[model samples]
Target: MLAHQQQHAVSQADLSVLSLLTQDQAPSPAQVASSSSARGQPHASTHRSKTKKGDGRADVDPLLIAAAAASGPDVTRNHYFHSFFPHPLAYSACDDERAALNASPPGPSTSPPAQRPKMESRQAPRSIRLQVEEEEKRRLERLERLRREQMQKEEEQKGVLQDKPQAVALPTRDGGFDFQEDGKVQAQASQRDADRIKAPKPGQVRHLQDDSLVVLLRQPSTPPPLEHPLAEPPFPTVGAQSAVKPESPLSAPEPTAAASPEARTPLPPLEVQCRVRTRIPTPHGHIFLHLYTNNHDTKEHLAFVADHAQMASTSLTTNAVEGTPILAETGERRLLPFIRSHSLDCKWHDGETDQERIVRGAYVGRLTETTHIASHPNPHSLDPTATPPHVHRSHRTTHNTSSQAPTDPPLVRIHSECFTGETIGSQRCDCGEQLDEAFRLITLAGRGVIVYLRQEGRGIGLLEKMRAYNLQDLGHDTVTANLMLGHGADMRTYGIAGAILRDLGVAHNGVRLLTNNPDKIKQIEGEGVKVVERVAMVPRSWVLAEEEAAAAARRAARKAKGKVSGGDKRKSLDASIASLQSLDASSRRPSDSRSTSLASSAGPSGYSSRAPSDIDGELSDGDSDSSDWDAKTDSSRAYHLRRAGVGMIGASVTSSPELDKYLRTKIDRMGHLLNHPTQQGTLKRVMSSGGASTPGATHQHPLSESVTSLDGSSGEAASR
Candidate 1:
């Protein structure tokens, strides 16, 4: 009867707890195990020790009562396990059976039973699968016993749910492993909160536990809030952060993204300013080039202003009150942009006028002829002699200065300076030809601009260019030499050129540019200035000489071949020598009396090519017909023919095979735009020339500034 009554009470308790569990947890294996284990939460040994005690209806739950006094060992007073099973009758049973358990111990112990820990503050969840399984097995035994009790006493179960026992004394919470109500409340509250939150956010790799995914991967947090109570952040400190002010790898500030020169760097802007505008009179025209200095490097650069004679007084007049020059600084012109590039000290006022800030000069025309003048400095003294520009300030020696500037876009050329080519007769390059051609074309057209940058040797300067020349002679090209010298292939920048154009006020309409380089076109045509037309400057002399040389070589080759096939070895040499001699006579022998008379006039002049009429090299061979040129061998004759052709008309006596090689390098290596029509030209030209059908990179036309840059060779030249 006692066993039946005990079974009945246990049946009522089991049903109540199952009903409290959520419906989702009913099927979850882990949750089922945890909840099922709640019955024997204190110990797994209670149910195991009770084995062989009948699994029938006679059995009573050990956890339902406080102890087993008659049939088995007494239940331990574990405060933590009692908290989980909070049924009121369970406490009364403990009070009712405590006296009985004391009289008879649960086991034969030599010493008192060990006291289990009651509460724990979890920083992280512990693996409790074994604890769960142990409790689950014990619960199943109790559940089986309850099921049989329900089967036998189904009618008795109705009143057990209504009955309750009075509340008993509960244990106080000690913050440590002593008993606690708060920890149990906190754990339940936290578990409920976790149930509401089902899954992690997208792409996050965190687990649903107290432990972190990767503690080492934690990065630096943002600065502490200004109003934070503690000076240090409230976050849990790791490593040496607590004792010492520490800097961690995780707490270091992230570096900004700046990985490229073009993106990350801010380059100093380009600049060109008009320092002074001076008038220089020449036989072709009066060139009034504007002088300027740059901020990027120390170099005195200039540009020729077109048709600016009327504006001369702006440069020369001495205004007593103005104090500053009108050309660069005058009347509080502080906002000028070029002033900053050159790093000039100036300031701009808020109410500055556009007109006051604007810098203006004069324009020249391409059609006008510049007045030619001569001023000998006593041929020995420093002071300039009596001249129109130097003698009297007011008197002007102008050439058609009355003519208006051209309505069309002004012609423009961006010429890099070359001292050797311009000062002396340096035919190693065509810098002289280019300078003359630019001046001639612009002056002939009457209105144009030429920004003469003092960029000697493509901006490497005079000394480096000479070194580059030595390197070139040692067999490296101009492009590679610059690289070997730690410079780019072409270091010239058109930024200043563009800026000067905008300052000149002539850029708004457009510009007629003179150049063969396609790169020049892209850079110069910007802002208000558009390249409306393109004009080419050609060296007719070089092209003609190259053609003459090719023709003479072919004739010598043909004559030698025909005579050698006749089987007379002596005749072969004779024919080859005869052929070369014939060419020498025909070219050197004056066809007219004027040729003989004009021999002196045909003498070598300065590097500057004479005007458009005398574009050909004026050959000045005095009465010497030497036999050394036409040697008695085919190879010898061919060599003579090549030399004769190059030096025939307009070539200087100094023009040798080295001169030809130097020039070929200019066209090929330095990328000079001029072309030489010779087999001895650039290897690029020779390979491209497939014999008697290919055209040259540039060709000469009587009046045309147009030349097709074809790489193929044309048929050998012929003389009239």
Candidate 2:
């Protein structure tokens, strides 16, 4: 532009000759280097205004060297404030005027081997010649892609490379090449994402495990895009956009190396359902209660279900098989009064007028039999996730095709809450005998469910499940008292029971779970719940009192090692010490006919046998000292299950060797699925029937001996 207005009129005449040389008084750099210029005579470098490390006087401002000598490089090198930033015409001249300004020819400059040709400005017509012909066709396609990557790096350094580019380099909108990421192709895409980018490096101490799925999924360490490797699919996919591939004479199925990265990664779904179901009535039966709502979690999760085609329809449970008042075959009898939320969504709005369509929620069987509940509700059924209207079909998504479905799926159970094992019945844990054997086997398999997850205890609540039951009564198990009460050994989740079994259409033909928690059937199976038959609960009164106290403690330990009678026929301690000291003198003949049989066979033990002294401790402490001398001469010792006490109901419970070390630390440390009682016996303290007391303490009397002085003022957890 007229050489930038003649270089801003020679930088305002070199700032009016350096404003009369700074009003006269600081010249000495050889008197402003032999004073010459009033205008153009530019040679001033008496070597001073630069050395700034110390002799002090080099402050050099003079209007910043007259604006870097009329915007430096003597202003013509295509005048755009060309950078190197230090140009006071590169240190204002004089080493013979910088060797005559680098031996001449700078005026029309623009270097890198002569460039300056851009002259198109009819007030920027055609936008500066289409931005200089798109910067010279992107500088001739970056000089033909760096001369075809310098002829394929000299044909792979002269091995005369033949055929390689199997098509991967994608990014290219006029590609200004900054390709750099190949440190052996980013370390082979980081060693093929070395099993999804693992991290823990700094000081590397990571141990975090309460059965780690990152402590039951606190998840996110950044892994998810699980491998794509561009075989032409980085984009365009949804509804498969067909740009033209009509030729398919049965071929395309190629991708094999046996596929699977879980079929190339999918999982993470969840969503939820059942906005409000109800019928709760529970002292062992009627449980509709689906009440869900999910996108993952916000507590209030539940399920219960037991479906006998959603029972109660004998015009609401039998007026003797009355025909159709089952909410008057769907017209909702009079707008859902007390039937516990069903409205399977049949549809009928009829321009809405029965309490705005039963508060915008019913329609399964009728949609018009005889109803009205006065009006006010349709504010979009207060959107508990809208999508309703299922008069007969609509709600799909668990992919159920139904060729007569039911391969026997249905019975679910997820459970979780314990409130000290279902409301104060805490026998330290059998979670209320697996929540009443999951509603008595889903009410005898009339169809199933049972999600009930307020995740107490397992997710640790009820004041940290009473501080993990005082750290499992100070003995810790149930997964080390939930990892010493911080939690996670079973944090419970089932994606809101797989979104209330995808809103009760029973998520496909699958379920039958109840559980032994292989992580609660792998977190309620996945996607739309699947489980398929697991059942195995094992409680029926701790299996008939642990199989009649392990078949009477193995037939009283094989009839006390078979007849070690005072007639001593000893095979038990591998015989001979004169028949093992005449079978240790007939095992001290019942402690010499009882002188408190060796301190009533001592107690305080969580587990410790040691009384044998070699002969494999006389064959493992002589079969728990012959089942503690047949429970000190059996006082009707049936003892197996049913304990539930607190405010008393099925109360009696006295297996106390402290509730058999709290069900043996909930079956060997809180994994509590239950069946390990073939016989690990230890317990034995129930005293007080009044007489056999101070000698081998057998005091049996419990069929409620008038609360024997309220068991010495209770609370040792209500006296075990």
Candidate 3:
């Protein structure tokens, strides 16, 4: 520290002396060098060597030589070295006095390397040492302050523990709330009180006597109100912890007086009431119509009215001149009250004009069911001026302003002729019976049109069907026989049906199907018509059993072919056609001579309904056709068995007592046939004898036993 101070002082002194030396003007180098050479000092040569760059190897002190030549000794000597050395020190210090200068090194050159040891030699003064000691003492005081602050914090925590018994129950001593254990809180409180007594000195206790204990008492803890009182606390509903203070509104008590009856005793459901209305038309003459209103939407509430005997409400008004209540002489007014009550906006006078659109000269009038309000025909209503059929098709595209397409015409099954089962009682199939059923349903609906196609035997012609029958007799199945007759298994198509539907304007909304055949459904559907509903057309009693058996067998065969047909799939279309043919024959006979002759022949006498003579005896021509009796018998038998099987199964066991009896009889007969002892014996013998049967032993078949087992009587079995 001294050396540093001395160096600083010397630097200030040097600046002062240097300022004095530089006060006069200095001499030039040439003169200074000349004088220095004259001096002959060995250091003069060193000077020359050092400062000879501008003077060419000359040890010349130009300033000194100039001063000497100018006759100034002091000026010459002083100028020489003064010009050569650094300012201030150069002038004040003796040029040959190196020892003192070396002793006290120049300010700039006095480094720590030289002064460090000297500094270490002196002991520091007591005042500085005392200052350091005081500083250390202040630091120690600060540390004590922090310690005291920390201790006070701990004391405050201890006081909190004393106030709140649960404070010390926590696992952590860091003073967080603890809910993990019991009893620890009370124990902690007692310990805190004891610690308090231990913590204060006698003097502190005296001061404490002056302090109020109430001011130190802990504040009571209260929870904030819940945001949603109806909601449970943060715990599972099933847990025991879920039950908290009665703050939840859901947990509030309820009054029993205001509770509903459902809360006490539940009652049976009340019957619902619905309103339904049906517009029925009768054909007793003059368009007679009546609306039937009921609480149920069922056909039983809507009775069938004969065609041309009734007229439903139309969008147009009925002519008042026609008569009040649109009465018909032959019609009854039983449903008038219901109609008047349910009708909406009905009109008494019809203002319809004949200028409207027409199909084949027949006016296409819209019949409004509820209100008899009709809209004037649009400018392009069917366009009768053009081709009626095409115009109708076009009109369908725009009939309803809001509808996607025109309403579809009712589905019509234009079934073709089948002579054997249909006309003649050739009931190998159900052609006759199914035809009858179709006619009945269509006539009942009163909105369907059946186009009778002439395509018989699936377009192979009736003769071929007979031929196919011969093949079938030769062991060919129905499909195989048809295929063998130089035709597809089914050659019929729906081209004519399509044309008929088109003519009838049914290409839009869709048609209600009356068939179980998926093929027929697909065929019509594929022809741009929707199949809304399917009405099953089953056959009559005689061929009814045959129809069912054939259907089931066909279904079985189809199923065995690895395809499923509930006898409803299109795969059974051929079977359906057969059924349809049976229906048509039984229902619609061409009012021609052929049907008349057959009807006359079956009208009693002339051996019309004769009983079966024998097992193979010919049936009287009256009841059934005798032309193909052999083939008919097989087909009829198949049909009868199938129909009966399906019918028996379909009949409700508990509901239909008569049907139940019939089914029971059938089941018994089937069981007898299946479990007949002779048949079983024959089968066993055949198996044992390498699949060969007795040649001419009359087969030794127990005919009476078989017959008795089948139907409990030989005569019954033979007759069947």
Candidate 4:
């Protein structure tokens, strides 16, 4: 009965509570019926008292009573009432008795049970049923008894099944026990026979509920929120509690998503600024370095030194004995580890090459290095049994494998190292463009090298170089400017370069030189080096213009074909022609006025080609050139003239104020030639239908002030 009540209670209680209990029990039919009937009122009642048996209690139907008890805790003391109708007493006896009782409706014997009095007996109606209510009561009692017995039997069977021995709850650490050899575990008995019981001893594994056989898994937990990792004192010893802290792995630290290098680490040590002094000997010259460094840093300092000039830090060492010229001898120098202590106070020095040196130093260590280059060798020839003869490797490569190994391409550079022109974008020279072009080719080839020699200002360095530039700007030509600076014209030499290149293994037999300087070509070729090839560094502007011209020509052709040639197309074409003409003009300018005047007298007639006559009056005679200049327009010739004139003017003015004054005196003394009558060479020559002419007789062309200044300075121009 108690179990029945409990099951009913689980069904009737609020779902949440029932869910907490049986998990699947739904509300009982009685509660559903009550909720449906009452509609608005709460179905649960309070203050329940169990009804006692045979205590003059009001008779209540058992099923109705059971349903009310199911709705929550009990409610017998409450005023709530439930209504039900029971079987009538007349129908209690038998099927025939019931049929006769119903058939005799409304006659004397047909009176209802409620209306019949206690003495209304007339043989109790001969056809009336007797003991009907008693029989029904007895049947109901039997059914209830049967249900109770079935429930009790089911419960007993369930208990027996649950009590049956299951696989023993051994420690998961050992794959659950072997039931075959040792045997099965009996319920509630002292474990005297089980060999390997999985439970906590006094000092072994932790214990949990023995009866429940639950094997609880325990993990090390994080401490409460009272402390943060940084604030908490570190653990003094293993397992010692210093403060509440985050759990971390024994071997490493805890992973934090927010932590970064800046946030996770402490500030680095303060930097100490100091300068270091070192000496480096190269084939070119002895280079002395004054490097600035932080005493706290090592790698950056060494890197800076290495890149500034490919100067590795090496110590001087002496060997007492040696055999060959190449081998170390007494007083012979050997490279060793280079190290120096840090210092704050440093001495500084002044040098003529300081500016170029600084510029070179700026990118020290910035360029990447090739440390482990792949080697190509004849594997079969380097027999495993014998030492290889082919590999006589340099310091750069690690090994000498075989004679047939692929030789690395010789390092080469077409260096145009001019200071002002390269760095400041000076249009006075093509040095910068040449340098870029050379580098581009070398980089494209990948295996070539560029030795960026710091011979700026033509090896005179920036200060003197600037002074020379000042002289040139003041009217002295390139030659006169150098003379005024107490230097020879082109005061530069390639001996140092030759030596450096040789030291780098770029022998005449190995390198393919790239340069247009004829003097350089002659000098380097003669310097025991094989000049296999001379690669020219063409100007990028020339290439770009050519590409643009081709594109414009294509566009013009298309427009003409479509009969859509507009005024804009013509204008663009004219502009391009004019630009080309200007370039042509500049190139034709003479270094002397006499030449310009002679060319003018000869004029377009001097050219064997008719193209010169085509653009005859469009440009000055000063823009004249050999047939080679015909492809360009007259304006281009003029541009070159103006540019040359400017350079000449600058050189002439800086040659010497006294020299200029003297030049004026000479010009006056030579007035006859300046104004000679019938000077046919002075007359402008116009091209006829035929071609070519020579100088006129008995007349000489006079010098212009610009031409005089340029040629009078002395010496020939530097060859490109």
Candidate 5:
């Protein structure tokens, strides 16, 4: 009975499961719970509800719940609503499955329909294509016609088919008959037949269409006779010409002149014209600045003429109320020829008026608003026999001025442009100072000329000159720097300068050239401008040094004399007065060996031999005590005042290491005729106990000693 009962229970469980499976709708939770309750078992729904109640959580994943909780209260259940939808990856999976299902062999229903044929069988006939084809056809036809005409012209020019008419057959794309004259057709046929028969064989000579007689594989044959036997050969043959003119066999053939290397055609002569001239009143004196244009170069070179004749006359006339002489008896005005530009004085055109001439600076005497006198044109002004219109009677004075006094030649300085030194006041070169000194000297001399050439950096332009400055900063000398930049050491040329000098009528007589460069002298002399004397241009620093040394010596002499007199106050004052007189006299005299000896004596015991530090201390002491010198005698005070005034004038350039290096390079390498301070034993003790002073030790050099003394003395004079 127990076995039967277990079997019946098993059969009933099987029947329930079968009935549930056979039902159309799945059983709900209520039905499942009822069935379980009836069977005396725990309902699945009840167990699930107990589990959910005990866990106290929704059906959400624990990770998602934790994420939501950590996201803060801003994230609610709505934030996770997107998770309920299908994941993008799941959609991709569905797409992949669909693609796989579709990837199987296509059935009739899924196959793509066949594309219908295009309405136009081929590509649509484009008008542009038709136009292009027509144009190409016309171009080909034109080319063929041109070719036929060219062939016909060539044959006629060659005289090969002079009587035959050329019949050109036009090319046809379609098979078509071409109309032609029967005679032309027959002629072409005959010509073709002749060519076929007359073609040259392997061993025969073939004559080219062009008149060349080239021999082939066999021995050369005589050329066929010309159609016109009397015609002259196109080119003359040397043998035939020589045969025509027979020479004596005994006499050597006339030697033909062979070209010599030195036989070069000379360059055209350089011509220059003075375009304008104007009187410029400078600090020194009045100068006539003449601008010149030359054929050799486009640069407008300048000439600064300090004409004593004109300047003296003007000055005398201006101060005539004071009864000054119209012409001074200095003999400079008579000896020096009047410097005038020939080209400027010449009439520019036939219709030119005196106002035009005066406006262009072609006038005689001083040009003033009240007095405007245009000079007469004198084309032969430069000729020896011709006299310039501007030359006055004072210039023609035959007082034998040359014999009365030895006339110093008119000073001339050929100055090349130095933008760095002149315009910017650079001390690397003494160019600006030299220019200023030149003006001062020329003004004092009463007659001179300054030809200013526009050759900056010795013909290298300003840009290259700046580049050379950088090169010089790299421990190279000026010459080496120029050479490194593919330039000559000095590429300056004086041709324009010479031309300008000639135009001014100053080069006829020799000039006393103010320059330290021997090369400039040689070059100017080569231009047919005579340089009778070369005036050395000593630096102003050196001049100031010499003056200071002399002054120092006079002071020392006074002091020593005071000591010899046993501190007698009156005797010392007397000695000081005498020394002051001597100083005045010496200062008035021109510099000579006496001044040089004084400088040498002062060099050993004065600033030149002293170290820079010692000089500085002495300068300080002098500055402190300068106030006491005011109580000295009037003569002594006057002497100091004069020296102080001179000091201010020569204080433009202060001594520095760069200036020293530049001077050294110019002296040692550039062949400039300047004396170094150390060599002269003047100022600046550049050489120490050793043979040469070190470049790095600038403080040891006494270059600033002279400068300091001058400054202190000037300051004392100012305080007084």
Candidate 6:
């Protein structure tokens, strides 16, 4: 109870001291002592005042004084009466107390003024300020430099205008005027103005008056003036000369017979020059890759020539000065003709040396660092008197051998570049597989050529081709997609390919063309190349299917034989084999009919019937004859399973809906001469419909009946 009373008394004293501090009048020393005594503390004010006078130190605690000073204006009355005092506790002292403390400055009661702590200045660093100044300076400099250049150009133009004399119009006899400067005719505006004023009437000739015209004639022997304008003038200005120059007489000496203004100038004949040739060793075999430049297009078309015998017969020891022999003196006669590029072997210039010719791959045999023999301009020329002793002997031998050699034409395939199918292995098309197959076939044939044309996506280009792919994803066929993108079904041309063939001496004799597109055959033949025979390039998938069917048939025959007695076993096996053969024959009849119908519809001159021998001969081993279907089938099956398995495994093992659709489009719309397996169902549908055009039928060609009939089964097969 006593402690509580004492706390109440201290609170009361604190309240009294706060009230006294808030008042305008200063509290007396006696009052401060009474307040201290009521709070149960010593009379600190009076004691501190006496101590300050005696020992120069206040009796008050320094910590307590500092606490009162550090306490913000909210806690203290310093905000009400702003004044500084020597005493730290008297921070909020009134004006009278401040004046009294200031007056007694020399006494021990006075203390030095309290110092507030220093604060950091809020300003940018010196480096940042300098950087900003430098950037501003550079910007100003750049603007000034631009301004100076512009002013200089304007001054130069002004000087040019000032120096050149302005043309004045001089009246002519026909009331027309000529623009003259410095007494010379700067521009003849009279004739142009007169012509524009009155156009010539139909069937009316306006005779030009000699007196009205001013002619500047030179002697017949003298050369024509270099500044003479031979053609019609452009819009006549005061001093401008004619902008249109006449077509040079030397450029086109013979005038075209066509007088129509819309007649176009005939383009020069397509000429291809083999720029470079190098031996590239591929996975199949070594091929001489020839890069060609043509007058028709800027693209670098290529030709992969597979002539192993030609390379083997031509030796490095052959004379470089004369013609290189088509056969080696010591070697056997070559069966294949020497497929050499005439443009590449021809002397490029009089200064061209044998080393330079050899460097450009115009050499006879395998080019080595130690032995390099350049080829002659007419390497195939059979003039024994002009050749060296060994070359003459070899040439005679080649001539004799070639005379008795079989007249089998070289295989030629015109393949377009396919970035998606060939480079990325796209399943949508069998382009990469076809290219590889072509290379293999040509290499196996011992003498062939594959012209790799740079016509990506049927000549629409890669960008458009990718766009076409998107359209295909949107449920459009390849032909329809190409049409939607404003491109033809097949925009490729074989003129350059034909020219390249001519340069290589392959098209001159004949070529067994490998292609499924009848249009390609037509276009190639149009280019003056003879296609002796048409070799069908059957898809590897179809080959695999045939092999599988053959295998299944054999397995069934074996199973039937295994379950019977000796005499009955033979009969059962024979029956099974006969049934399988009958089924195979039935299945192939429709395809055969379709091919025959297509050939007849194409007319006699269009596409010839593909001989079974050509197909078998193309894929068969050298030992097998055309009639040996079993051997040929086994050979092709083994090749696809072994050599092409890595690249075409997916195509062989599983069905490709994209590939099926692509093939269907080619057969139905693009007029490609290919037989699809699904053609059986389509033929049945067409026959059932009485050859009427069914709804959703896309085929639109003369051979559409035959083509559409062959389409329905491929989709069903792909689904299966």
Which candidate ranks first by lDDT, i.e. highest?
6
How does each model score on TM-score?
A: 0.34, 0.27, 0.26, 0.26, 0.45, 0.46
Q: Go through the candidates in order and give the C-alpha RMSD of each one to the true structure.
A: 35.5, 28.2, 42.3, 38.0, 34.6, 29.1
lDDT of 5 by residue, 1-720 (tens): 743343233334334534543444445555444444433345443334334443444432333433333333233333323544322222222454456546657665574433322223475469878998999999999999999986675455435333223322211122211111221333454453345334534543222321211111121212223222222222110010110122222233332211111332232356666777889886556888888765445577899988655544322121222222122323122233456777787766543444345556776556663344565577333223223332211122222223222223567889878877776677677776677667655654456889988877776668877887888888877766666665556667676777677666555455666765656666676676656555555566665566556556756875776544435544644554454334322221222321021111111112212222123222322333233444444533433433233322223443556667877776666555444766554443212212222222222322111111212122123224
Compared with the true structure, all predictions reach lDDT values of 0.38, 0.38, 0.33, 0.32, 0.48, 0.51
Task: List runs of model 3 lying over 4 Å from the truth.
Answer: 1-401, 404-411, 542-720
lDDT of 2 by residue, 541-642 (tens): 333353345446755866776745633424433452233333322211211211111111111010011112222322232345444433442221211111
* Residue pairs that clash (backbone atoms under 3 angstroms), model 5: none
* Candidate number with the higher lDDT (1 or 3): 1
Stretches off by above 4 angstroms in model 1 are 1-265, 308-406, 526-529, 543-675, 680-720
lDDT value for model 1: 0.38
Who wins the TM-score comparison?
Answer: 6
Q: What tens-digit string does per-residue lDDT give for candidate 6 at 1-720?
A: 743343233244456656655554455556656655654454443333333343444434433433443443234553433344233434443455566556665757555554432335587899999999999999999999999986776466445434434333333433433324533554443665456335644443222322222111110111112232222322111111111112232233232222212343333445567777899876557889999865545678999998775566444322332223232222333234467776787766543434345546877665543334566656656422212111210111211333333334677899989987777668899887778767766665456899999888887678979998999999988876766665556666677787787777666456767766667766776676667655555555554454344445655775775645657644644564453333322221223222122111110000001112223322232112223543545544444333334543122222389988898777666545565655322222221122333222223322223322121232223224
Model 6 misses residue 45 by how many Å?
94
State which candidate, 1 or 6, has the greater lDDT: 6
Candidate 3 lDDT over residue span 651-710, tens digit each: 201112332332232223211111111312221111011122222211222211111111
Per-residue accuracy of model 4 over 10-79 as CA lDDT, tens digit each: 2232443323223223347654555434332333321011222334444233345334434333233221
Please give the lDDT score for candidate 2.
0.38
Clashes of 4: 34
Candidate 5: lDDT of 253? 36
